[model samples]
Target: MTSEEPGDSSVVRRDRFSGGPARGFLSSLAADERIFEADLAVDRAHVVMLAERGIVDGETAGAILAALDDVEAAGHGALPDGEDVHEAVESAVIARVGPDGGRMHTARSRNDEVAACIRYRLREDALSVVEATLALREALAETAAAHVETTMPGYTHLQPAQPTTVAHHLLSYEAAVARDTARLLDAYGRINRSPLGAAAFAGTPFDVDRERTAELLGFEGVLGNSMDASSARDFLAETLSALATHAVTLSGLAEDLVVFSNRGYVDLSDDYSSTSSIMPQKKNPDTLELVRACAGDAVGDLAALLTTLKGLPRAYNRDLQRAHRHAFDAADVVGEATAVAAGAVRTATWNEGALAAAAGEGFSTATGVADLLAMAGVPFRTAHEIVAAAAPDVEDGDDPATVAAKLDAAAEGVLGENLRTHVNRDDLEAALDPARSAESRDSAGGPASPAVAAQLDAAADRIDADAEALTAGRDALAAAADRLETEVDRRV
Candidate 1:
């Protein structure tokens, strides 16, 4: 071991080494700044656990804990020159309380300590993303409720295929967001597990209470296998996977709104849109465009994380330090995208009159007429043929009577009888109306008004349950922090 300076009180004993370009290249202080508080909490918890287990004397534990508090109060700028935040913090503590401060690292390695810090901070980050997902879900469901009767043309292959209400379309996205929220909560289960006692990838010889540290850190439980706990990054990969899928869902929704805005079916709120730099008449959906682009960014982050973790043979490697950066990028990007999408959905205005007018264009109600004919004793295939025959004669402004006359002529040639003989004009006219056509679809999970209302109610209940779950998780963490702090105060 070598000391860096002669007669320097703050010099830390370490193996002989040269510090130059390689030190700056390997330093993680920039990224580790995000988890500085988490590192301090882990130190306090570990020291308290050591004292309770008789692994360290009360006097040393108290001095170390007090020094940790001082180190934290000094802020990031006061951290010493080191390869990572863990070393910097430990160096600060030793500088403050002399050799007694070094006792704080008893029964733990930087491997387990850094892993615990990542998990502690990631739990809060995952919860925040879940909260944002819930907000978007609430916005979608409420918007659907308000538009239950707002009729519009539903598209397939970007062509008008049938009539559907705005509520039904909006509710589709709400259902997707509900599933996204569920996936994130499921991923949290793995993220909340603690890896505190897996010191240097093997069981510690010291009598350490892993569960005590886990409880103090608000973890659901300790990761059972020491080696796996020290090196496992699957939890981070799973979180990024969930976030990436959610970003895809948001991208699809953004694309739909962009298409709708382009087609004059809906108008976006000005705040979510932007004006082109050179074009005077352009109102671009720039926020949604960015949300759409976030899918690629999130996917890239997940891929990068997996690539970094792949082919690693062991319990702990320096490469693991690079993994958390990708996770942080994914979480931050998706969280912001989710918030912007919620705002866009909440403030958007639908052009109800324009939607109603366009709902019947391109022979969109032809399927309703065929179904009506099928219900009135006409063979479904024969009804299809009859409608196909009359489609050429149907004009944009043709009235129901004119359309009925064409259907009759086509039926006479196809079935040897007029369509009016089987179905009266009143029935044909009702089937030809797009609004009635949409209402006629009363099947379960259909786009009818009543069906959409039921869906909205169910989505609202799910949102409430998820919101409560998030609150409970957050409160549990807060209680654990309070308990840990209280224990620290009593010991020190």
Candidate 2:
């Protein structure tokens, strides 16, 4: 029995972790690199607050800030090597400024650090998602304006239900995206609190200024409870849930685009659509399909975070670090997918004749027929069934008047002359025409030309308001990041 040499034992241990005797360390795949710039901005604010409050001497604080700046300047702050980002940062600071650089962790723990970084990232990414949503809203508004008078068939249960202007259909999506933007903005409000200075699962003994850190970090305030700050992932879940919802909404619109782009229906321009590689006759709506398919990844991202947090312990766990990859992936997926979807809407062409032909189908005017019978004192159900029976086997191109005339002659024998006083065949013919039916719906938000015009105008105003708000928010974030850099440079 002989003891192994120290070098030999080290070699064995390295192989155990590496699964090979002499392979180079596995290079990080960089699957889900976080928004490190935002995290560094937060770190800068935390250091500045420590100096201002005298928690660390001004020189040490200045050195740490300078090291951080240097790291950022060298290819945007390469993440330090450790179990996680907080450890990586602390290791870097210590390497740069001796033991005093380690003092920055005196009152903070990786638990609090992780929470703070996530919050900072959430706040930044939430605003970017909102901006992307505003772009989609703007494109929808533009589409609505271009097609305000282009009639199309609206459906219920995928069956033609009524005649609606194409603008009306487009504006429906704009309204949906506007609501999605508002939801992301609301989530940002909830994520705007600072989690720094919480220190693990409890308050620190040192007299640290959380409010000052919050101000420097551009957070509205310190999180109210230390324990909650360390353990809560609700903000991340909620923000990503909102993103997933937006993705789902866009996927639905994309599905509609895919269907509309097919030769079986509307003929979309070749610029916005692609042809199949192996089949010359096949024009594939690949862009819209991509938009539709990308939604599943966003949804999977939300589910992954939720599953990771489902049974976690009170304080932070190593598993929490693993959560970053999916959250980061989700934001990038959302941003890119949303931009693609918006571009498709802006550039795609619509065939107005196809839309008009779809609208003119007599089946789409059944509701108008029901309205007509109700106007003539027939009970609504009775009117519906009556029209349903007489509804010109439109498959055969039978006119509504011709169908109504046969029904009128039959009723002449069944209900005597009383039916003649209530029903006019000519009136029925006018009621069953889709163009007149669309024009008759002059109510607000209806498919009537004027109604759709007003909706387009309102959507434009909302798009501008949303875009301006997003711009103001982004400018503020940029300024905060700039201020941190400026302050760090000043001290250095």
Tens digits of per-residue lDDT, candidate 2, 51-159, equal 8878888888888888777656763236443334454555556666766666767678767876888888878788888888888888888887888778888887777
Estimate the lDDT of model 2: 0.74
CA RMSD of each candidate after superposition: 2.5, 5.0
Cα lDDT of model 1 by residue, 232-289, tens digit: 9999999999999999999999999999999898899999999989998999999999
User: Which residue ranges in model 1 land beyond 4 Å of their true spot?
Assistant: 1-13, 17-20
Worst 10 residues of 2 by lDDT: 1-10
Q: Estimate TM-scores for all models.
A: 0.94, 0.89
Candidate 1 Cα deviation (angstroms), residue 69 = 1.2
Every candidate's lDDT? 0.89, 0.74
